[model samples]
Target: MDETTTAGPAPATTVGPAPVGPAPAGTAPVGPAPAGTAVAAESGGWLELLADDCSPGDIQRLRAALLAGADDATRRRVESEAQLAETIRARLADRGRDARELRVRDDLVRRLASLRDSAGLLQEVVAQSRFLLGVDVAYIMLPTADGGRLRIDIVDGSLGDTLQGVVLRDGEGLGGEVMRSGRPLWSESYLDDGRLRRVRSVDSIAVSEHLGGILGVPLRFGRSTLGVLLAADRRPRRFSDHEVELLAGLAAHAAVALRNAQLFEENQRAVADLRQSNEALKRTDELRRRAGELREQLTAEVLRGGGIPEVGRAVARAVGLPVQVLGADGARLDAGPGTDDIDVVAVTGSAPERWLSGQEPASRTAIGRDHLAVVPIRMRDGCAGCLVAVSDVRIGDETVRLLEIGAMTAALVVATERSVAEAELRTRGAFVTALLAGDGDDAELRRRAVAADIDIDAIGVVVVLDNAGQDERAVAAAATRIAAELHGWVAQHADRFVVLARQHDVASVRARIAALGDGDLPAAGGIAPAAGGVAAVRTAHEAARQTAAVLLALKLPGAVATAAEVGPYRSLFSHAGRDDIAAFVEAALGPVLAYDRARGRDLATTLEAFLGQSQHHARTCEQLCIHPNTLYQRLERIGELLGTGWREPGRTLQLQLALHLRGLAQTLAPDVGRRGNTP
Candidate 1:
């Protein structure tokens, strides 16, 4: 057991981790004594010729000259030295046994010393072999992430374009098999091997065997082979026993160098981990110190409510941010942290999407110069609004977390402020509405309207905006900006509802929708329209909504949309409750439902398709991909059961309305239920 442990080897550890950062590269072979002293080893015939003078300087110069050859010996640099140098001339003849071992031993020592001295010693070994071994080409392939494949790390210049970084998996190429078996392999002629034919990168079998003699040794640290080291001579260079020994020695040295690099990297990682832990601890202490002060500021802001722009400002300050409050949809509510010296950046449509879709941690960006955090402000579990935090530096985790907490507290503050502002606006909007309705004094209403940011006498249109999704911040922001723009228009007449929509009920306003012409507004897409608003508001909103829906329905590849373009459904404006439509459909579709229950067929999908097809036999058949006979039969059965034929426009409309209502019910009812369930 002891002998095996020392000589036979204990099982190998995993291929050490990849070296961190850059490593020295090239290859040379040497043997190591028990004390780890590297001694030069003899090379086959070449080493004897090179070591003729048997001087260390001579050997060094020879090694350098050989290593100097172009990766492919396409040039005669190494060959030139071999020809002119006495050592090179000596290689033209055979040398004595004592001289060969001495030469081999010296080469081994230098190779081992290089490995021990450099970070990328393995790479160096491959480079040295190309110089010293008179090989036409060479490469060092390493195992990939899975260790199931070999990847070429370095290749000769001639093969650079073709084989550099090429991957050869186990059982693949001549090199791959050697890598898999942890054995030295040689192909005196590569073209003859059936296995080499399998190498994918080698397009031609002739090309694979072009090397006169190809030699490979598995690179192993212990029992596991990292990959294979390959050397190829384009001309028939005899593979001497000493040459094999030298290559094996280099392979061993390369493995050890790789292991050392991996250990150095591991030590570095340990230090980095310790550093991060210490940094995290420091941040925790900072957070703790600021927590108390932040909590007080937040409490005070909450008490003031959202109407006060100062409250948003206060929250930003508490979290050390220069934030602008926004609605859930991403609207700039009231620019907090003052806009005087502000620099605007890119704006995405919705605040929620922006916040949630962060690819990187939010904290880092939140503190960047002119960085803004658009935080949604929630009240009583509902998102009442949003706020932005602008800072001079990139935000850290501590900053983001603190801001999140502060926003929650600020929500109540901002909401309270909004309530107060809305009360005043509502008083004015009410008078204006009454005047428009002919129930109030017009002059007084007009005067009040102007105060509420509305010009009752203006010929301009009113607009009421609401976000369709949870991201009200952007929508609310667009509303505010549009309102400001409408107010700025010189139509010489006032548009009612120029004030924020917060004061008015979204469903009660009614008017014809007039969409803005392309020239009338900036091309911001995805705005929702409010059809249920006061005259101009409803008109403008409906136009916007219709535009949005049409755009959405069109499905243009890259067309953008805005809330103002997406109009409310006609049903939303109707006095009739949607539940009535549902009741009607439930009553009419009983037979179809019954049939579905009996047969387990998806009757609902079929009915939906049938109705949408407008009773066109060809279209319906194509859509359903059924025979005309089958479609007709189903339609007939449906008509008999539902008391409506495909041609009955009125009944068809009713069924269509039913389907739409049911879908709406499924989606909208859940929120209603959840709200009702809440205390």
Candidate 2:
């Protein structure tokens, strides 16, 4: 039969020559059979089968015909031509498919732009994707908050309801694989595919939906996979690369939509929060202004000499709290009205002194139903006191700050009062000094003393402190304390504090001075016997000066010696460096001194104490706090050193005179007789 009359469709004209005309009926075929006649005939039949869209059985029959009697060149030529035809067909098919895809993409873009909300846009997108992809089911599986799995959030197409809320674990099945790999994945027969991890929940859902194949594409934004977009078929199907790319494009649009929706919602909440914060700030500013006015009013009251009482009342009225002012000595200076329930004493006693020392104001919870806020009143000296504000209602920070300002005002008042009192004391002290120094007339001195609230005519002892090594201000402070105790006059005499106290109160004055003790200095004081009138003041002062001199010259610290205590030493020290006194001290203490030097003993000190006690062994031992036997032994040693004539009547008189002179000489001149040699 002719080529046109063949049973199958005809092959392309470019493939080869048509079938030979029956080999010219008898003789040879035409002209060497056209290079490859037999192979061309076989190849032509195969091409015919390709053009007919034949079933596999028809294509198999055509394969047998092409192979029969075909040389290697024919086989190669057939393969090359077949590949060329396939390429041409694929290019033509792509051109047609691209036109269709362009149309679908335009429709998707138009639908997405027209939809006002993310939910509508996403639903429409999945619906269009399912229709375009020709799948049984199409859905979006977006990541949950924790990003460990994906849940179906949008669905469309046949059997879509079954996957409405289906969740896929990470790395499980096709959808999980796409999300984890951030790429597209497809399975022709999902249940039979061993490449993907199988999950019971995913498998059960697929079985129920009659799904045999699936294609999944990761929904990506930048480098992050937002979720997976999936297309599935009921019958087994091999998904095309083109179909995966289309779904991935749709997923990218969906990610942008979701992110936009989230941003719009977040901005809306931020605007609402900002408005609320603005309203609260306005309220706070108003409170601050009101607090400022309260502080101004309290300050005005203080400036008008309202004192601590007025301050307390102002604070109580402004803050609606009970207020109390405590002095440095813990005395309650003022308490506001209705402060009966507030325990001023307990609060002041319990106030933290450390806080006051550090100058840090603090508030604390108090007993009963009250709250206590303490603001310390500080001055140049130290903490003057604290203002304690008590309230049944809780006090806010602004109110506490206002109370601190009030405390500062009270401290100013206290500091001013102290300054005035100190100035007055200085003036009185100057007048008393002039009177004691005998610089002015006696009558004039007495008159000035009376003017300064001092009684010069009263009988009183004159006490003098010498070489106290204290600054004038410290001395003044100590003198002020002592004068307050004695109700007497205290003056700065040279470098000493001189006091003229009442005769009956002299013992109390001495006790007070002794109690004052030696603070940061070695103070020596001397008290004269009580005498009357301004004429006797000079004599008593001279006696006090002499006694103080003796105390200092002897290196005796904190010693308050009187006229009676010094006895003969007063007369001996008065005539310092006299020949008769030196000779007598040499005769009496010479042997004891020599023995002490040779033996490295304190025999001279023992002998002096023994003789000072008038040879009373028990009193001397008691004074020394030593055993009587020890004293007796020392005395025996002294007698041995002195040839046993030291305790006789005439000898004792000489010895007593010498001991008195030696003590006086040492006090007068410290270097005399210091080398174990008599002066």
Best by TM-score: 1
C-alpha lDDT (0 to 100) for residue 71 of candidate 2: 100
- Candidate 1 deviant stretches above 4 angstroms: 1-119, 156-160, 194-197, 203-209, 287-292, 300-308, 318-321, 328-337, 340-346, 349-372, 390-396, 414-679
Q: Across residues 367-392, which tens digit of lDDT does each residue of candidate 2 receive?
A: 55666787788888778777777766
lDDT of 1 by residue, 1-679 (tens): 2221222111221111111111122422232221111122223134453444342223333444345435765234554543354333333222343344457546755665555433356556776666555577877888889877788776663543666667777867678778767888887767665556375455463274465678888778888676688888776555666567667777776776676667767877899999999999988998877866777766665554434366566656767556666554434556564543543334333234455344323333433234555555557645655555556565566766776766666665666655765575456546544544445454665565566655443433334332234344443334445444444211111221233232232222211111322222222232333332245543543443333333323333123344332434424222364456556668766677778889987666667888887767788778888898887677777777777454478777877776766665454343222311110
lDDT of 1 at 14: 11
What is candidate 2's CA lDDT for residue 519?
35
Q: Which candidate leads in lDDT?
A: 2
Which residue window of length 10 is worst by lDDT in model 1? 14-23
Query: If scored against the real structure, what TM-score would every candidate get?
Result: 0.45, 0.43
| Global lDDT of each candidate | 0.53, 0.68
